[model samples]
Target: MRFGVAFLGAAMMAGSGIAHAALPAGFTVTIEDAGVKSASGAYFGGDINNYGVETFDSLSTGVHSTYASTFGGSPISGTYSNLNVHKADQYGGAGGNNNYAVAGISQTGSYAIDFTTENGESLTYFGYWLSALDPGNVLEFYKKDGSGGFNLLGTFNPTDVIAKVGNNASGTNPYYGNPDGTFVGQNKDEPYAFVNFFNETTGFDRIVFKQTVASAGYESDNHTVGWWKSQGGNEVPGVPEPATWAMLIAGFGMIGGAMRSRKRISVSLA
Candidate 1:
């Protein structure tokens, strides 16, 4: 696909430090162009233990401090601060369709979601559709430290993805057009992408979205979470655990050899 080269260079330079500083030793980030559709298709497989998507459709329009919902049959409760749910058309970079999305508001230009599953399992994967990317928008992942504090695991933004994969060249006129057709021709100057964060070791449980500039907001939709599987053959460092290997073998046996042919990209942090 085609990308804006000039913008890509600038984004790379600006986001370089954030990527290095925020990503922990064992975490990786993957970015994919959704291309006129949602990225929901990428969230499945034997590798994922449990997964869910929060569409924000059921929530009322306003600031919510606590929200609970089930995604993909898994129960998830989230605590938020200064997070507001707005109808799609209410925001400039948002997708259309009478649907809804969440954004950070007020003086902070930031908001966060601290997630806890009903079973209290650690989350290994987090992803979302980032629309109308801006330099001010920043996303951070964190894990709970032993002493009731949190440790930052990674920091990312749409610009980082553009620096890697470039920008969407095809699709509607605006590269970042809403696949749902709600807000066509809007945010033409901005780029959009589906970003996935995976932790190879211990996983994270909290996500924070912020806008560094005053009055700007962080807008996103289809927040997804899952338990991810590592990739490797019989090798040592990257190999999956025995239990996971067993699950993969069993899954491949049932699904047939065709599933093994599907292509996937895995990025490891340096």
Candidate 2:
């Protein structure tokens, strides 16, 4: 059930223009940019052994330097310098109901979530809806070493994923006209995406979301985590359906044709 190169190759060939950071062998990443929170929930929350999503609805509005909660069956604690909870309508393309989202304010803005379980179980899957991506935003993953220290696994950002998945930040993006339509036509330049990280060989227990630049803010909602498992007791990662693959292939075909035509014109002009 580990989706390795064969699945990735099909996704690429089908034109599902998603890109990912270089991960350890047997790790993979998937991204969804065109849909709303429910879509991402279904994608990541289904057909798993355990799954949960943190919508930030119950938290009081304001800054939270330290927060603790349980997601799925995993106990999680978060520490941040300036994590602010704001009404979802305040930000364009922010996921969740009309509730709230956690934001890392500009300048020294960052948050870290540590999964603490006495059993020392690792999580093989993670996901979040990242809204209004800026160049300064970064997402880092870490694994706990046996000695209470954390080993950095990988670092990623929205721009890198968007470069592979094509920008869908326009008004046509479904999230722009979400329920209540409060965020319509706002923050059109910044893309919002649901990013999925999966590891088949080794799992991680720590994740960090930060904004490196002083000018930008990191806003996101619907933090999700899960352990991949099928009803048959086999480990299986969530993958795109056949219809999704067909759609991606058609989209990629068009893009490829356009690029080829542009290349021909450039050669002729040269």
Candidate 3:
């Protein structure tokens, strides 16, 4: 084969392998501020194939939405049904109806959540969550290492968000705090909360969100986990799902069969 054709084939093969997913390493998960009616349209994780976000509005009020989606309603393929969706927002109101965010629960105190991808994913550093209250409430992040040890990434009081982030309210960088916080702002008071963090360099299988210890459960608005995606200029390519592998194999097989049949016809003509 000519060098040009060989190079084109290799490029084409590489293009076929690109898939939808966050990069496992050196990826940044950014969480922006949310309010009753947030005008700012943004995402914490990577781009979605549908709906852009995995909002559990399909769930009931004050109930955990059990699904294998990243956040919205997209389904995770195959037996890799580890991605679960949980939402605590009970004040369910449509966008611009009552100026309410599909998320943002009035539940008081603290709430927690834990997620573990099948093979475990490499994370940049840590993650953050949103809530309705902040004063006296706390949110903590932890990652389970390969040795089966749970390491505390960091503890954040929404009240301290403004002080820490100061002005960075909406950047890809981890420290770009949430200024539109509805929870206890840096442990300040109600209607003023923000539980967000940033990356450092760590590989964690499981991520745990420990709500600030209190009498009641806190309203968990969101959890931001930043992973890089190959389609989005990922440093490393992602592995294809089982179904994708089958399709690729079938496509190549058909091409091979067609080529062999064409050669047979050519010999008969000659």
Candidate 4:
């Protein structure tokens, strides 16, 4: 078989150059300020290599919004670019949880979001670009109520995201993989980021995510936040059942009783 030196060189150059694109274009993103209301922190983790950033070209598909907050709600729109996305990996002797380590970008601390939807309802999904697969970790989603209350929506295992990144391949020095539960340093299989219920009816907006840490001999803890936009308006799915209202009223009654008892105790003490 005849080998072409020129073709080899060209291929190498192309592969090398794939990662060196300019930062993402300008965007005026909204992020909430601290002390307003926030759920958990969002993390954006990734690493840059000789080839360039380990980004999935399809990662930013569809219309999505990003936000940041300390407690929850209180959102603000801001700008996000390729430069600001967090990317981290194991380097040097620093080793704790290989999969335990995750890079995070926040909509908080000057973070928020805005997105568009054509239909009456819009769906927001969550994910990230996996430089490597970490089955030990899971992605959690939280939803915030109007008065700054939070509820855990669901948790996603790496298995759910495996399909999206399977075809993605990385040309960088280090590689990342998209295989279900496989972690390789340089695969371009970027995972999707989302919140299952950010529709108009919910009247709820904003989202955040963090990486889970688990290792046999070592334990790791990490958190991060991501932002999303609401279709905007007073609408959502699923009606609150009569039982739901009963529970809510009963809960309030309990609180009221507690308050009255506290007052009586204060008087007795005086």
Candidate 5:
């Protein structure tokens, strides 16, 4: 995939001192007992036990998305290329709600969430739920490379992203067997499996989710509305951390002391 070399260089120069380590290869998927929750504005760092992990449920407005990217206080902001949102109903006699979750566009193409307005933050890890109603549906993740473009991170199976819904009893709709992994409820869980990458501290300003159409006319509805956690960048650190600031101040103090000592010695020697 292509990268934004110039932008990355500038970013590192500007904030490497405060930057965290790169996210490692592969991501983690946790099954939460609570149902998918929606969050807005800046993402607050979650509980300490989760190590600052914060989960957000992203839902589409059921309308065409544009550059502005706001669904009335939803944490989602991105463009939908030539597609509209779809809600679940009995499509082709399937009674499951997978076909009607947020971001459930069937056309299978690339969709993005823009966080550039939030000062272009970074994230170490990110995962979202996808509903591949049919077997052939596929999804992929990408992050901005910084040059106004995208870089592919990983490809996901609809099977891999199915939500674990026992935590929410209302979602109990029986689902067919998935070749990937079995779900807790016979009913399909709004898939929340996350693909972990080795880079643990690399913050991503934007996330791109792409869908692959199963067949010529048949489309798998995409659902990003379930809970998914991120490692960092819920709130962009516009300034250095306290420790970094302390180090800077101490460095300046040492430099001043050394200059003073050198001047005194020269005077004495003279």
Candidate 6:
């Protein structure tokens, strides 16, 4: 890929402190379990997860994406040129009930950062703007401790905001093409979510997101969300354990003492 030399330089300068860290090297945002009913096309809901190694580049030139639904399957990856990002507040139809082929840039390719604390812990912090959605659409946060379970941080519902809507408007549902000649649901606008994380003490490696399907029907509610990672970013520093640091410090101290004594003896002999 083509990278601007100046930008890369700036990225390194900003991320110099963590150059030797063992933290994540990048970040990824993904939507999971996202879809509405294939028949009624009512309310839609799914999970959005932004996980991956923490990096400085992600905070600078990361990418955000929303894919057309494939019904109940994973989002199909697309070419970089084919990816489109839009503002979230530009969509969401009239009264917050619509479905059409929607896509846009959420956060304008900005930074969503995660970091490791001094205690050898990891935390994620992200920020972004969005529009177009029902008055009740919500985004929930979660974290995994390398265990089999997930912890819910909280829920962020877009109030007085906008969101992207997916519909089968033109009858050409790329995700779920109609058997006859008419699509059921079409995605409308693009909604973006920016996330931030911190307090990475346990060094966990997974994150999950879930959207609540409120009162809207099963088909055309709050669903259809996906994300892609922007390559390269700042790396979180890996702080050695207290014991490890102590050992290294002690070893260095011994070496320093030996060198000083040798210099004194050599001077006396001369």
Ranking 4 against 5 by TM-score, winner: 5
Q: Candidate 5, after superposition: displacement of residue 233 in Å? A: 19
Per-residue lDDT of 82-200 in model 1, one digit per residue for the tens? 55666665232234654444443343366787878867877887777676555457888888998998988778754454443343434332334445465665444455556667778
Alpha-carbon RMSD, each predicted model: 14.3, 13.2, 26.4, 23.7, 24.0, 25.5
Give lDDT per model, in order. Answer: 0.55, 0.52, 0.31, 0.24, 0.31, 0.25
Model 4 lDDT per residue over 164-255, tens place: 22212232211222222222231222222221222223322333233322220111112122333322111222234533433322221121
Q: If both were scored by lDDT, which would come out higher, candidate 3 or candidate 6?
A: 3
Candidate 3, TM-score vs. the true structure? Answer: 0.41
RMSD of 4: 23.7
Question: How big is the positional error of residue 84 in model 3, measured in Å on the Cα after superposition?
Answer: 14
Q: How should the candidates be ordered by TM-score, best one leading?
A: 1, 2, 5, 3, 4, 6
Residue 128 accuracy (lDDT) in model 2: 73
Give the C-alpha lDDT of model 4.
0.24
Ranked by lDDT, top first: 1, 2, 5, 3, 6, 4
lDDT of candidate 5 over 1-270, digit per residue (tens): 111333222322333232122222554433222222122112223422211222211334233334343333334334433333343432211133432222223333445554432323444433333222322234444567768787666544332323222121233323222212222232232222222222344444455443332221112332222122443212211334444533322221121111110010010100
**1 versus 6: better lDDT goes to:** 1
Across residues 1-270, which tens digit of lDDT does each residue of candidate 2 receive? 011233323533432222234356665676654554432434444553356667666666666666666653444433333445666653423443444443344323677888755456887777777665544467778888999898887776543444435534233534332332655554443455566677786788888776654444566777777665421111222444545544433332222211110010010100
The worst-scoring run of ten residues by lDDT in candidate 2 lies at 261-270
**In each prediction, how many residue pairs overlap at the backbone (N, C-alpha, C within less than 3 A)?**
0, 1, 30, 65, 31, 71
lDDT measured at residue 178 in model 2 versus the true structure, 0 to 100? 33
TM-scores for every candidate against the unseen true structure: 0.68, 0.65, 0.41, 0.28, 0.42, 0.24
lDDT of residue 228 for candidate 1: 60
Clashes of 2: 1
Worst 10 residues of 3 by lDDT: 261-270
